[model samples]
Target: MLLCDTPNLVSSSEVIAGVSDHDALLAELRVDSRRPTPLPAMLPNWRRAPWPKLNDRLAEEMHAVLQINNLNDAWTAWKTTLVGCVSECVPSRKSRPKRRLLPWLDKKLKKMIKIKDELFAKWQVEKTLESRNLFETARRASQGAVRSRLSLPAPRAFPRRKAKRVENHGERRRQLAIHVLDAKSATGPDDVPAVLLKRCAKTLCPSLAHIFNLSLRACDLPTDWKCAAVTPIPKDGEKSDLRNNRPISVTSLVGKLLEKHVRNQLAGFLDTNKALPDNQHGFRERRSCTTMLLRTLDSWTAAIDKNSGGHVHAIFLDWANAFDKVPHQRLLSKLQHHGIDGAALEWLKNFLVGRSQFVRFGGARSEPCVVSSGVVQGSVLGPLLFNVYVSDLPAVVKTNLVQYADDCTIFREVTSQDDVDELQEDLALIDIWCVNNGMQLNAKKCVAMDLSRARQPRLPQYMIGGAVLEYVSTQRLLGVHIARDLRWNHHVDVQRKKAAQTLGFAARNLRGCTQRVKRMAYLTLVKP
Candidate 1:
């Protein structure tokens, strides 16, 4: 009394029976249950079913019945019928068809389509206008709205061109001879006058001509040649030569300067009247480390906590040209105020203002060129000099801000609109200080986040760039990647791996470490 007569259904049963292993067959059955099989196997009698016509309600009903009954074979059969129906419903391409319309329906559909298109166009235009407005606002804010205060001067009109000076044959020959002589007498390609250099070295030294042309090109040079060329050299020539000769030992000068600066600045703070004990170095080192660590920890905790009940906003500031743009006179005044004097002040001033050369590869060899300001990038004293210059800002703002090198992050709790406004004003003052000190704030890199918004009940988050920035539960820091939700077993596994590595290294080094000692060392090395 079987109603089904599909040959494919019989074949499917035969394929299922061909699997000998029980587990393997069961796995195959699980896969088959989830998805449809090929049409040939699932529906051998698919052609026999009545095909559903275009827009037929019965076609949907038939498909629904197959799906509800979990009949994959029946679904495939119905799909084939549906495809055939669609092919029959499609109008012939060669024949021109007359449009059949109800006047009311035609008018409504046409009106709806027109409205949709108009709305789309309107939306695009509005979006573009909004974006342009935002850009203009940001640009105006960045430029401090100074456009109204300033007026641009009118461009100067060029005078009429003069007639060309056509040289005589004898004059041309004389010029050529002078150029050749200049080239032969030149110490290097750069030594010759640019025009003569180019003419002489056009063929044999094409690069020389190119370089000469580049040098002769109009540029912004000092109006006073004396200021440009007559730079002061060291009065103590012997000491200058010694400093140049022993660059590595230059740290002695840095240390002596640092010691003097510290003494001068901390004279009032320190009990100068009392005799100072030895071991100041150890005491200073420990104090500095402890202070820095405590400050860092406080910042990290404040940044993480969201619902410990505070309206916290953190702003990070970056200064553009922090070292190079420092005004020489201003810096000297500040140093003098701190009691730095005599030879030390002179040396420091010279070090800050001295020009230095950097060599960059230009294909075959390194080409050397001088820069006007800033500590030389790879020089030993660069970081020390930079740190010294920027040391004042943090000291002044220590009560309100935390600073590490160039990065200063300001934190404040705001519970009301007034508080927020006040915080913004405070940040503006900081910005002004930076500007006055020849630094600039990088507004884009700065983040101002509200910590009150969190998706989870117990989780803390900060709003950054319109998204919640949660503390990373798992992250890599200083090469070690820590796992989130660390368990006892996982910790044990980590320790075991680390122990094996340590033991291997020890063995290679011909050192002894027992298994127990190795495990202890591993635990010590990797704290969590």
Candidate 2:
């Protein structure tokens, strides 16, 4: 008999109830939070030693501490000494005051802010109408004062009338125009301004086309071009912690333009050559998470239709820093395997090698450090390179693998216990592949789910690196809620909540705004 009919799988409601009880138990064991959480301790701005000075000190210390010629050991020593020097120069301040966001905030505004704070404190102590009214008045005055100081023009008082939302041909054209303008204005992190990009693209495309047709090309890059500026952005958790941040590169406008052309050529060539598997959907033509989901559902349905009474078990695999961890040499080998060589390959190698980056946040910029690995983030070619890097993963693993860029789901239909063993074997094989490819599986975030309509489903426990994977009743695959029973009620409920939140934001911000603006917000934000 299939595991789904084995009377072991718990119902959704039962799972929810159990989760609630578990949460209650955790809350009881944890400390009560009667007071507000304190802000993170941060170093003073003045104490932040200049990057050049830190680098000099770091070099001296690394030379003194490290005797080994081993590259890995040398790197470890360098990082350790660098951290020490940084800490010595810029020590943490536990009681440091919060940094003000507004630079132009004057003494008058500060006084008003203090008054408002006092009023709030009083209201917190004693809830009275007079205190509340005073607080509201002070808040409005302080805000108005700030706006007035900034020389912001006051809105013209027009007679209030509800604008009709009735759509016509003219309105449709106007809305389309608004969308076009908005998209044009919304440049990404590494993108040049729309005007500059248009001018460059127009002038460069024809020459670029000619270059693509050339049989031989030199590996020389422009010497005058500045290296990309690297900025550290918080991945998650406390921003004050250096470990929480990852480097993002901002390259030159011309570099981005050239990369855009390369990306287009590479994507076309790969698609035409059928180098990417049909299961690989991300960054590929006419493929998406939606299509992947539909195909997965169809496959499972077909299995059921075969009268095999099999259960579909899926493992959503996550990689730790997938793009950043790709081995450059291996990537080059893969590109060559896919018939990319000569000028194209050499240009890509130039793009990848000897790249330096500096950490920039706010006004403070660090000294440049050489980046040994990873494709440049925020570049047009980054995703394409990553796709090509992991394109052959399907051949490495035995099971049905569905990939959306780095997001992968391995699924197999199981009837007997022997089939469950096969699924585990496939996971082991994938682990070996990841090991060889210089990537690590984030076993904690990985989850296993059994998809079945049967009342009870029993599936084998999967492990990666000796860590047993968590079994989930519902798993979110590419922003879509997927459950064992394939019911969409949970997904719909989540989307409805998100839509309501967006609608509330529009109601607050676009209340007195133009009807067209409101419509644009509705269409782009709420509708999606």
Q: All candidates' lDDT scores?
A: 0.40, 0.68
Error of 1 at 68 (Å): 99
lDDT of 2: 0.68
Q: For residues 32-119, write the lDDT of model 2, one tens digit per residue.
A: 3454334455543333445455445554565543354443343344335544665776445555435656544778899999999999
Least well predicted 10-residue stretch by lDDT in candidate 1: 221-230
User: Where does candidate 2 clash, by residue pair?
Assistant: 4-456
After superposition, the stretches of candidate 1 with alpha carbons farther than 4 Å from their true spots are 1-293, 299-307, 360-365, 376-381, 394-399, 451-528
Per-residue lDDT tens digits for candidate 1, residues 368-404, read 3344555433333454445445556644432256544
TM-score of 2: 0.61
Clashing pairs in 1: none
- What lDDT is reached at residue 528 by model 1? 33
Stretches of candidate 2 off by over 4 Å are: 1-194, 197-216, 223-226, 232-248, 304-309, 508-521
The TM-score leader among the candidates is 2
- Lowest-sum lDDT 10-residue window in model 2: 23-32
